[model samples]
Target: MSGPFDGLKVLELGRFIAVPVCGQLLAEGGADVIKVEDLDGDQTRHNGPIMPFEGRQYFNKNRGKRSISVRITEPEVLAAIQKLAAAADIVLANFRPGMSESLGLDYESVRAMNPRVIYGENTAYGLEGPMAPLAGMDMALQALTGLAHMTETGPEPLVNPIIDYAAAMLMAWGVSTALYHRERTGHGQRLNVALMHAAMFLENNQLTHVELLDSWRGEFVRYLKHAFADGKTWADVIEHRETLLPHKVVRAYYGFHATKDGTVGVACNARTQRLKLMSLLGIDDRWTSEPGWMPEDAHAHADYVYRQVATAFAQQPTAHWIAALEERGLPIAPVRHSDQLFFDEQVKANNFLAEVEHEVLGPIKVVAPPLRMTETPLAPRPPVSLGKNTREILAEAGLGAGQIDGLFARGAVREVHETLEDLL
Candidate 1:
């Protein structure tokens, strides 16, 4: 099937994760995404945790998009970019405050050129906030939004940058909404996405913990200390341990009995499930009978189920446990590492990976867009090298050969590779 955005044109004047990821999603949806890079390319091009074929994080995030290496500070290059923007259906930028207007690529300028252009801006913070000018990265935003503190169980808090990825997803959703609105209204709109705001929104429930429960702060601290002391990591502590109080029943629920082999995670929060688990394990029902299980006892109950399941699972290999759980109609999944995800049978069955031939890297595997539309399946496209499509895109913009050469000579347009050495 053809893609949903077959005829749409998008000009992405963004860098790093959030905005570039949004553009990647649009490209996967079949938009003609032109990524505007500087002479040195996006900083993500140098980011590590590299794939076997992709240069760095950059190639992974930028697949299915063309690149235009232009020095936007230069008038000629800036003018050329503006011309491209004028012809684009969407313009995405993640610049600091005033940077877009200074470069003459803001929504106002693009709107003047094309009333139907949808402009999207992503920032570290909201445009009007006191911290508007503060630079934002996933780590910084995590700290600013209190996510770091909320997740922390130790004296010193820890932060994870996965929050940035979530923010990018949110930005993509917002942009898609704006595009849908434009389709109906026949007028474009400006969209703003801030990493800080996104992080806070993601922590909605945690933020309201104090407001919703009386004496929640003291209880929370005590829970935190106990969960941490129990040897759980921050994520584990916050989720399964600290969130619930410790009591006899709770201890029974959360406790895990280790067997000779692997471990299994089990939850028996519901009365029926707990009874079923107890019956299956041949455990005494008196555990639940004494002192009706209070809300604080939930943790203990979970621990009890966890221990039983762990012991049972330890008697068999992971595959055996999986089959046994399925046979019993129990909800269970073996934990998997990120690298193992690609090899998952379901992932392969769903065509979650796409193979592309690269000039330097030869055949490379890229993760396919996660969004699935039965009627309009996404098509994989190779990422362009720096300014690889400069001449072609400019030609589409109606620039003659002589004009193109003039711009090339003037450094208004750069080539992807000037020499074989560049391929390396």
Candidate 2:
């Protein structure tokens, strides 16, 4: 059976992660996704932990989509792109606020041509905010949304651009929902997903504030502000914040422990599981059972238990701990590097990775399509080269061969015939 979105057409005017990924997800669902790139291509195409012409970052996000390179500033090129947008069922863009409007590819412009188009827009911040016009990136959004401060080992942002990916998921979900709405009402709507909003989505549980129950929140903020203004170091600020915050009694049960061979994560949430773990390590569970636990006493007992557990865990290898924890029905997992994933038995069993041969990079494994459907399973497609479909896309847009040749001659469009040398 064909995938659910087999006949859908998607036009992606996106750079970097969010929009490209949204388009990718749609393409995985069997949409015909065309990624429009500037003459220089997406910035990520040159970003490297791999070949400069097609970096891993670009490879991972732009899969399953055809690419067309054009200089949108040229009126003819703009008109050609508009033709694609007009025919698109869904239009995705991640340009900063007003950037789309300037390019005449905004929701208003596309909606005028195709009323049934679901236009998905991604930004660093929301469009109406004072910071909307200012450029935003994943790390900046993480810092702005307190994720940086929430890190245990000082104010460090995650190496991965999680917010960008999260925003992409939101746009994909929002666009899918809009498609359903259009199916029902015969009308399309615009959807906006901001990285700041995605940060909030991630921290929703942590961001809850009830004046009666969370009065310390205000005091903590004030204390943090005063501490920062006084030029206090992050360690100093963290120390003060810990004193103000409520005791995290179960924190010990939900943390990584360094074993003899490697790290292992343990998550023993239930009382019985904690008791079992304590018994296995030959540590006292008296503090957990006893009543009238004073703050100082509880802290001392917890510290002792934690240290004992740590010492015991360190005595064994990660594999040993994993087996022991599994035998006891406790939750535990050995920490493995990303490189190990391709060879992992569990990953292979689940078919989580798919191998494809790239024209330039040769055979490689990539993350498989995320969802699984028994009837209409998602299929992984090989990566397309930059400007690989430029000529075909222009032809599809109703431009004749002569027009295409002229566009190429004027440097208004480009095509990658067979190799990265085409771009160079």
Total clashing residue pairs per candidate?
20, 0
Task: After the best TM-score superposition of candidate 1, give how far the Cα of residue 255 lies from its true spot, in angstroms.
Answer: 11
In the range 311-376, model 1's lDDT, one tens digit per residue, is 555676766655755666665566556688778899899888878866665677778787778898
lDDT of 2 by residue, 1-424 (tens): 7887899999999999999988888888899999999887898888874554577788788888999999988888888899999999999998767778898899999999999999999888888868888889999988889876455456777888889999998899999899899899999999999889999998886888777767877888888767868977777877666666555474667789999998988998778888889878877656555544545645566677788888999998888888888999999998878889878999999999988778876787899988899988777777777799999999999899999999999989887555555435
Q: Lowest summed-lDDT stretch of 10 residues in model 1?
A: 246-255
User: In the order shown, what is each candidate's alpha-carbon RMSD?
Assistant: 5.3, 2.3
52: Cα error in model 2, Å:
5.9
Q: Model 1: residues >4 Å from true position, as ranges? A: 49-54, 146-161, 204-259, 263-274, 282-292, 295-317, 397-403, 410-412, 418-424
Error of 1 at 318 (Å): 3.2
Error (Å) of candidate 1 at residue 35 is 0.7
Estimate every model's Cα lDDT from 0 to 1: 0.72, 0.84
Q: Which candidate number would show the highest lDDT if scored against the true structure?
A: 2
